[model samples]
Each structure stands twice: as structure tokens, then as C-alpha cells.
Target: MKQRYHVLLCLLGVIGCLLFFPRDLSSALTFTPQALYDLTASRTGQAAAKPVPFVSSGFAGFLDENGRPQYVEKIRYGAAVSSMGIINYDSVSTKLVMRNRDGEIQVAIETRGYPFFLKERLLIISTDRLRLKEYTTDGDLLWSATFPSPVTACAAAGNRFLIGLLNGNFLYLNEAGEPLYSFTPPEGRIKVAYGAAMDAASEASLVVAGIDPQTAYLLEERNGELNSIESFPLGSDLRRNLLVSSLHGGRFAIEQEQGLLVVDRTNLRRRYFSIPGRLLSVQGHPESNLLSALSQDDSDRFVSMIGSESNYRGRLRLAGYGPGTSILWSGNRFIILVDGHVLVYRLELI
Candidate 1:
């Protein structure tokens, strides 16, 4: 039943791109779309930033800016591809294959775990879920830690990372893997933590915990101590985990029922924006107060840009196929991955 739920949540295929190019730029430049593979048979995956990462059933790799595959490899257990490189683990050999941007084998490490990227660092959660290892992008181990209970959720920013365990313990750790502070949300029927997010500035952190009645808490760090500034009740059931992110301008956003609750941490002001479908991915611009979200309901998909005060700026209708889709905003570039294909757009405002 758990595997069935995973499959149901993963099969969101995108078929076309959002033509967001302005009229003037459309005449001066041409935007081309590329299909890297046929992912109709593929089950679950996601996309990352530049040299975008694409993963299907048994294959994984990264694509260059032009939507061309830089490297592609077959895998068995798990794979984590970032703008930095690729980390693939083969259970049979009990080894990890690390590759560079150009698909060159840089190094190989022996480990049995699921490799993933946390912010700019590489981390692997042990198969037993009791241990965590952080490694540099080059496949060198930086630090590792053991937890008394299973790690249920994690998030990272700037130089700090937060890890939440099944026992309701949340540990805030610095770059050296040293714990700075620990917290546990007060009162809950079930203690499991579902998700967490922290901004790059380390000013605020968000966590959603419990089962029967999940709750979202916004926390502030001051004088080396973490304090809960606000708390909100969340829906009892969720198809996807909470979409919690620390946005620009001292603001944070949380995915509520059918809209997003945007709050300013400094003044405790709030705004809400209603999204049309199942929210897939959200990316916030670091330099500006621009927020982009991707959503899909059945065969209809959309990419919307939001400004301050939950103001709707613009939206583009996207068409696509398969079982998964995601969006990433880096500077003025908007990247969308549908099924197994990658589409990148360079936006210029007039």
C-alpha cells in the first residue's frame, strides 16, 4: 500500500512547455525544447538547478544548459545528481560512482545508502536510517553522525542544517556537523515530523510535525537559542508533504489547504495566495522578492510568478506527459522538467 501511494503521487507527466518569451525577444531569439527520453514507462523522479538533473526508473544523469544530456548511466539502488556531479550507488558492488559535470569518473566510494543533495553538500542516509553522512561535492566524507532514532526529515541553508528524528527531536547543526541547538515541538498525538525548511540566512526555520493533527511552527533563532514565534494548525491529511520555504525579504511560505500562507517573520504579517492545482515545486529568487510555483491538475499544468503581498504577476499554461514534473528558478532563468525531458527559458523583462 505504501508503494502504491508512492506511485500515485509520482505519476504527473508534463507534455509541453510554457511559452513565456516576450513578443520582442521572440523575434530576436529562438527558444528550442528538447526531449531527453520517453518517461511514460518511468515511475518517479524530480529536477534540480543548472546542468539539470533527470532520473527515471533505472537511469539518471544531468543535462547542460541547452537541454542536452551531459552524462547518462544505468543504476541499481539509488542516484543523486546535482549541478556539481552525479552520485550513483550499485547495491551489487556496494560502491558509489561519482562523476563530474562532463561525465568523467572522479572517484568511487563504498557505501550502502541512499545518496541525496542537501543544499550544496552531498549527504547519504544510511539504509537503517540511524546514521547520516555528509560529504563534499567531490565524494570526500566531511562528517557523519548517528541518531538514536530514525531521521524522518531534514533541511539545509547557508552554513546550518536541521535534522528531525522519529523521536520528535530536531537538531540544528552547523557546517562542522556540531549541534548548535535542539528542539522538539510541544504536544502532539504522534511525534513523527513530516518536513522542515530553513532559510539561507539562518534567521528562521519551519517544521511540520504529528500525524492525527499536523501542526506547522515558525521558529526564530536568537542568542544561540531557538524559539517558536508562531504556530498554525494544518489539515489532518495530506497527499504530499508540506511545501515550506523561507522566501526573500524576511518572509516564509507554507502550503495550506489549497493556497499558500506567506508570512513576514519580522512583523508577523501574513498573506495568502490560492494555487490552481496540486503544487509540484516552488522556487524563490534570492536577489528579488519573486516567487515561482508549478502546479498540475490532471492534464492541465501551469507556472505562475508571484510578487509581494500575494499579488499575482503572471502565469503560463504548460502541457506535458508522464508521472513527474518540477521547476527551478536561478537568476533570470526558468527551468522545467517534464517526464524525462528538460526545458529551459531565459527571461528578460521589458
Candidate 2:
């Protein structure tokens, strides 16, 4: 009986080693909410700088460094921003040129007739209705033209502008808006266009996501030819209300009916996670691989920052992923940018 008891004890020791030893050995780490909150708070006290304002209808206006309103001048039609921050406007000209921060006129060429801004690129919708027009940053029109269908969305990717259209078409244009190469997508699929990016590892290659009747296609550009690298069907929940926001490099974030999905553009692998509360607004960082979402909890509002894979793991494992999310910043200062004017919030986060 003593010998039997010894054997049982040995077995229990082995089981404990298997269960607990590996976790300690792996050195897995996580982030704490307190740390994150502290980091964000530190950024707040450092004198708020006024952001450039582009105002239109309602209360659409930007604030200067002194908190003065800077309204968009000569606004003929109301402009709408896409989920990815693309601004779309309706006008008669085919070729439109607008000034940038450097005071240089950046020309936008449209094949179809649509005049829209994607990222920083002004896209011409249809080639048939193409018209050329020059404008100053102060909304002065210097020149105007009419062009044709197959209008494309343009965005500033690195140094060059990537132009894409609805019909699986693409083009690379210089800063002067001169076309470098015309790109065509594969058969039977329409290029979503908004989520295109240049591969981080290879600037010569481009990554773009498109959708067919049933599946999403992730394609890679090699020497101008688009090769299908990954494809997957949209989740049933996502398919119901598929709204894609920002696409970073090869990864894209989408707001689905179920929650948010972060997809790897190269291999089509994905990670699915959801915020506890309803998402009010979402934005992506331009230089970093992070996503910040604004959500409201009960009566309070909060900002949640989800960094890259490493930052996410750090937060979840170390700090403990809790209800809702780790509040990055919150205040009763309800400020909602809708239809132009900033709607103030009555709730405050103490």
C-alpha cells in the first residue's frame, strides 16, 4: 500500500509539470489597462494643437491652432467621406486639380465622371464624362475638361498615387497626376479599390482585396500582373452588413454585423474580435499598425486602442481583457462630427 501511494504521487507531479511548466517557460506577456490609460493621459496634458478644418454643410469646419474655425471655401456640393476617409464630391469637370499643404496643384484624372477623394487622391469616376479643371487651395478654379466611364479612386501610397476603379482597373500616377502604368484585375471579380496597399516587404508589389459574387480575393501585384494569393467567403454575419474601414499594408479591418474582423491581406488569415459596446467611430493610424475605436458603454464613452499583434497580446495577457475594453480616453465632452458641426456630449469620465 505504501508503494502504491508513492506511484500515485509521482503521476500527480507529472501532470502538474505538463500543465504549468510550459506557460512559465514561454514568457508570454500582456498589457495592463492602467498602463495604457496612463500612457494616453500623458499625451492629453501636452497642449492640444488645433487640427486643420474642412467645413461644408451644417457645422462642417476645422479648427485652427487657436481654436478658430477654418471653413472650406466655395463649396458647391456637400462632400461625404468614405469609411477610409475618402472624400467624394459632385462637379462637372473631368480633370480636377486641388492644392496640397505644399501649395502645389495636385491633378486628379477621372475616366468615368465621378469626382471623389480617396485617402488624399481625388478620383475621377467616369472616363466618358472626363473634364479637366484647375483649382487653388482656396477653391479657385483655374482650368476645367470632360472625360469618359470606369472612374477610379486615388490614394497616396508612399510617394506615388494608386488609382483604382469599380471595374477591376488600376493605375499608378506620379505626384503630378501623370499615369505611369495601367493595371487590370482578374476576370470575374470587381476590385473593391478602397483597401489597396503596397507590400511592406516589396514596394514593387501591390496588395489589393476584391470581392466576387461569393468570395473575397486578396491579390498581389508582381511586375504588373495580379496573382491571387488568398480568397475566403465573407462570414455570414459580416455578409449581411459588410462595411470595411481602413486597410493597412496587407491587413484590413472591417465592421461586420457580428463584430470587427482583421484580415491578413497576404494569406487571407483573419482574427475575429468584438467590442462589448456599440462602436461609434473607428480610425486607423497612418504610420503604425494600430486601430482606435470609439465606443459608448452604458452612459459613458471611451476610446479603445488595438495595436498590432504584439500590442494586442500584451494587453490581453498581461493586463487582463475585461468587459468592454481598456479605456484609453474618456470624457463627458461628447463631441460627435456629424453633418459638419461637432455635437457636444453631456457625459464626462471622471
Candidate 3:
């Protein structure tokens, strides 16, 4: 009888101890965010500072055949509609120029969303019409094609090109400008595409998306045909914002309120991250989900490095990022556009 009474007391005491000292569910879990950039590190750059020297203010930049970045500004004839262009860089020896029989061709090329570069070819796509001209680095016109609707954006691989149209039409063409596959988006869905990304590894197939609640479509190139592999819905959260393309590889990013909505192009694997400030613009890795986000923290500006899994890694406070200030990520370099100066920083993860 005494032993039974003692056992009961010990059990009651143990139950009371458990009730008083509960375990935390989350505290036992282990996870570490990717990285944080070293605060003391800074990058260097060059100044493209010079006079506008042109009648019109159409300035753009592109990578050369040798993988060097070159800037082009439109040079205009005095009060005429003719558009001349000059390569405004210190190293003018490797500069490629475009000229026509009468004068300069009236076309300027720039990426509408992402900084996609082709190693060998440059596409001169008309912003106002349904035309595309492929040019070699030496300024040779290789091929040109006209579409049924106005071309919205263009993405290119080696000899393959994917063209998005304003009418929700997608045309997949070869190096010779022959139409391989044509796709029209769903009847009730968004047909007018905002951006396009071509995955060179996926047989030069493409992923395209637009604004109606933001859905992505993976168009696979199979047996010389374009097939709609999947249509991944991005939900209603991405509605009505200015949808731009930031697709690199298996992932694509969309601009959101204070961060980026990065998703896997194949599986719709969503990763949304919020930087600690109002997002101004974003650039990221073309192969991974590493994003260089530029945001305004009150009156100051800062750049934060987001990881592949959408974790806040590190941040760098920018000195003079303001209105009309632009930034570009060239894989290993961060190019900041400050008026006439181009600040280039070798991206280091610290």
C-alpha cells in the first residue's frame, strides 16, 4: 500500500513538471539563411560621361561579340527624321556601326525586361511594328521576319528565337527565319505577352507570360513543333501590376510591391521575398534565383542580395541611387547607371 501510494505521487509530480515545462515546436527546427554581403566592400566603375551629342535621346547598351559591353546613342540629322548612331565608348576600335544606303537605319534595340545577351547575334526588333531583323556582330543583316501582330518581346538562343506578340501569339523561328511552331494562348486567357525567355538547354524552347493575374506557359520544342507543356497559374496576388520578364533559367521573376515574385518556369515553384524597403527595380542571376534587389529605405537606397531559395542574404547601401538611376547585373559585375557614369562592381558574396 505504501509503495503504490509513492508511485502515484511520482507520476503526478512528473505530469505537473511536463505541464510547467512545455517544449517549443519551432525552436527545435534548424535552418540557416543563405548569406549576407560584407558591408565594407565596394565596387568600381567607369564614367561614360560625355555630351548627348544627338538630337534625340535614344541611348541603349549591348554586349559585343567579344563579351564586352558597348553603349549606343542615336545620332540624328539636323531636324530630319533620319537617325544616326555612334558607339560612345573609349575603346572604339571594336565598335560595330549600323548604316544604310541613305543614312542610318531608324531602329533601336533594347531589352524590354531582362538583360538577355546572345554571344553571336543581335536582334533589331521594331518596337512600333511587326518586324524583326537579326544582325551579326559585324553589322551584317542575316535574316528578317514579319509577324501577324506587333512583336512584344524577343528571346534568343544560339540559332533559335522566340518572339512574343501583342495578340497573345507566339512564334518560334529558326536561324533562317523559318517558322517552326506557332502558338495562340487560351481564348479567355491573356494573349498579349509581356515578356519571353528561351531556355537554351531545353531544345531552345521558351516560357512566356503576361498580365492577366500572371500565369506562365512553357512551350516545349518537340519534333519541330511548339507544344504547350504547362500553364502554371501565379494566382490573383500578381494582378494589375506592371508585369515584366526577369526569366533566366528554370526560374523567372516578376516585379511586386516591395520585392520580387520568383517562380520556377517548369513547376511553378513559387518563392516570394520582401526586401526591407520599397522596391525600385531588380536584377538577378540568369542561371539561379540569386536576385540583386534595389530598394528605397526611406530617403536612402540599398541593394540586397536574395538567395536561390528566396532568403535575405546581405545588403549594400548605395551611395547615389536616385531618380533615373539604373542598375544591371552582368553575372560577375554590377553596372549602376548614374547619369553619364557607369559604376561597375565585381559582385562578391561576403
Candidate 4:
């Protein structure tokens, strides 16, 4: 009788404890509603500072971190979206105006060609696209370079910039627009560099160049010199500029066909993830393994949250197809414009 009473008491205690302290059901990756606004509404003005740049509904503007409209204006020619700010061009005056998120004008340059921002530097491409000039953020002309072949692609990180030429050559330039290293991939039948990316990190800065005929070259900058580390053969032809990004876990991602080819930096082992439909853009968390991708599979458009370790998190469906749909991801917030509604979703813990 004593033993039976003791066993019953222990079982009852366990049940009571479980009932009182429940297990945490929080998810590692989830989304919460942050803010939403209708871009169709008449919300126009020069907004406050510290907002993300977006283009929608023939309007270019800045949105706060909370996804609220800061500054909205009717675009004339076109607008270039950058992490720092935006470059709005005036076709009539042939002037390019650069503005920061704080609604402050950084520089205004009058050029016949279109001007785009590469980090803090402004690049003005000639009307024929054969000549390129680099300028400071204050609109001072630094240096000009004319290429015999067409410039296929370009990327900038911090003080460094990479330019890929159609002749299969790639050039790495320093902060003063001086060439640091230049190389051409030998094995490619078509000597063309499709894309290039540089690391913004001060330590162990890496340079990635994607060449035509499906090859990616990796270079590391150390002790003021660049050394070729490794090369990977991508099976598909990169028709457009390569979307290569160095991730958190010593890995990098290259957009190929209907998926992303994620390669390990150490062993050069490759893992492919099918992102469904055509991959538009990829945004990754700097400290974590999370990557967000925007894709338009046929007429259905959505944003997929993916793990760098080949794990599928979830996806959020956006408005249907057309020029009206656009999405941008920054920090933990996702700003999406579907049709005319602008919806913002923040990464949640629950």
C-alpha cells in the first residue's frame, strides 16, 4: 500500500509540473506584421531620413524601416536603387540627382549619359556605353576609363570595385580608381566575364568573378596582393549578370537557371536548391544562414525564406504578375509591393 501511494504521488507531480510550465513553441524563422500602406494613395512629400529606397507605380521614393512612406515622387526617366540611397535622373536636363534616405541631396551631376551609384562612387556611362567615368559622392570627377570592348558587369564593395569586360578580362580597382589586379580566365571558349563581386569586410576580403562558358573564379586579397584560390564550373550559361554573394558560413551562392548553386568555400563542394520559376534576387542575413529569395514562377510571384544549409523555411505570396509587383528586403523587414498595396513583414521570433 505504501509503494502504490508513492508511485501515484510521483506520477501526479510530473503531470502537474508539465501542465504548469509548458514548452516553448517559438519558431526559429517566422514573420510578423510590421506595416502596410497603399502606394496608390496620394502620399507624396520629402520624407524624413533613414529609409529604404523603392520604385513602384511609376513613383520612386524612400520608406522608413517600419515600411512607412518617407518621400514619394514621380519618376522622370528612371531611378537606380542602392543601399545608400537612390539616383533619380532628369531626362530633360540630363542631370542625375543622388539623394540619401534622410531626404538630403548628396550630389547633382549634369551628364548626357545615365549615372548610377556603385557604393559611394557615382559611375557615369556614356551614351554609347563604351566610356565610363568614376566620380566621388560630392560629384567630383575622379578618373575615367574607356574600354575597347563593352563592359558586361560591375560590382562595388566598400572602397573596391570590380569590372568585368566582354573580352573575358576582369579588373579590380582601388579606392583611387587605380588598377590593383587584372586577369582573364583562360579556359573559357568565349572570353567574357558575366559578373563580379567584392567583399566589404576588412579582413579576408574575397573577389569573385564569373566568366562566360560557365566558370566562377575565386580570388583572395591578402597583404595588398590578390591570389587565385579556386575555380568552380557552373553547368549552366550565365545569360545575365551573376548573382554571387559570400555568405556567413564561408560559402557563396550563384544564381543558375531555376535554382541557386551554393558552394562551400573550403572544399568547393556544391549544393543546389531549386527556388521555383525564375530567380529574380537574393538577399541574405549577414550574421545568420538565412537567405531570402524573390521569384516569379509563371504568373505566381512569391518571396521564399531559405536556409543556407539547404533547409526550407517558408514563403509569402505576393500580388500577381505585371510591372506593378516589386519586393525589397533589408535588415529584418521585407517591403513588398503587389498591385498597388505596399506590405511590410518583419522577421518574428514566434
TM-score of model 3 relative to the true fold?
0.59
In model 3, the runs with Cα more than 4 Å from the true position are 1-120, 187-190, 202-213, 235-249, 265-268, 275-282, 285-289, 295-302, 316-323, 330-333, 342-350
Model 2 agreement with the true structure over 1-350: per-residue lDDT tens digits: 68545544543443355345322211332221110001111112222243443332332223333332333223444443221122234456544444332223443433225445444433443435234332333444433433233333434555555555545566656555566666555433544443344433333333243454334445455785546566555553211223444355667665543356677665657876665455544556555555656554455444555666433421112122123222111221212232222222122112
Residues 18-84 of candidate 4 have per-residue lDDT tens digits of: 3464222235555655555755466555554556777875777777767877666666787776556
- lDDT, residue 92, model 2: 61
The Cα error of candidate 1 at residue 60, in Å, is 4.6
Candidate 1 regions with alpha-carbon error over 4 angstroms:
1-60, 63-69, 72-77, 90-93, 235-240
Least accurate stretch of 10 residues (summed lDDT) in model 4?
A: 202-211
Shift of residue 344 alpha carbon in model 2, Å: 9.3
Q: Please list the Cα RMSD from the true structure of every candidate, rounded to 1 decimal place.
A: 7.1, 16.2, 18.0, 12.4
Please list the C-alpha lDDT of all candidates, in the order they appear: 0.69, 0.41, 0.51, 0.68
> What is candidate 3's CA lDDT for residue 162?
78
What TM-score, to 2 decimals, does candidate 2 have?
0.47
lDDT of 2 at 20: 54
Mark the 10 consecutive residues where model 3 has the least summed lDDT.
Answer: 30-39
User: What's the TM-score of every candidate structure?
Assistant: 0.77, 0.47, 0.59, 0.81
Measured by lDDT, the strongest candidate is 1
List candidate 2 stretches off by more than 4 Å. 1-50, 54-57, 64-76, 80-148, 174-215, 219-229, 236-250, 255-258, 265-269, 274-281, 285-290, 293-335, 338-350
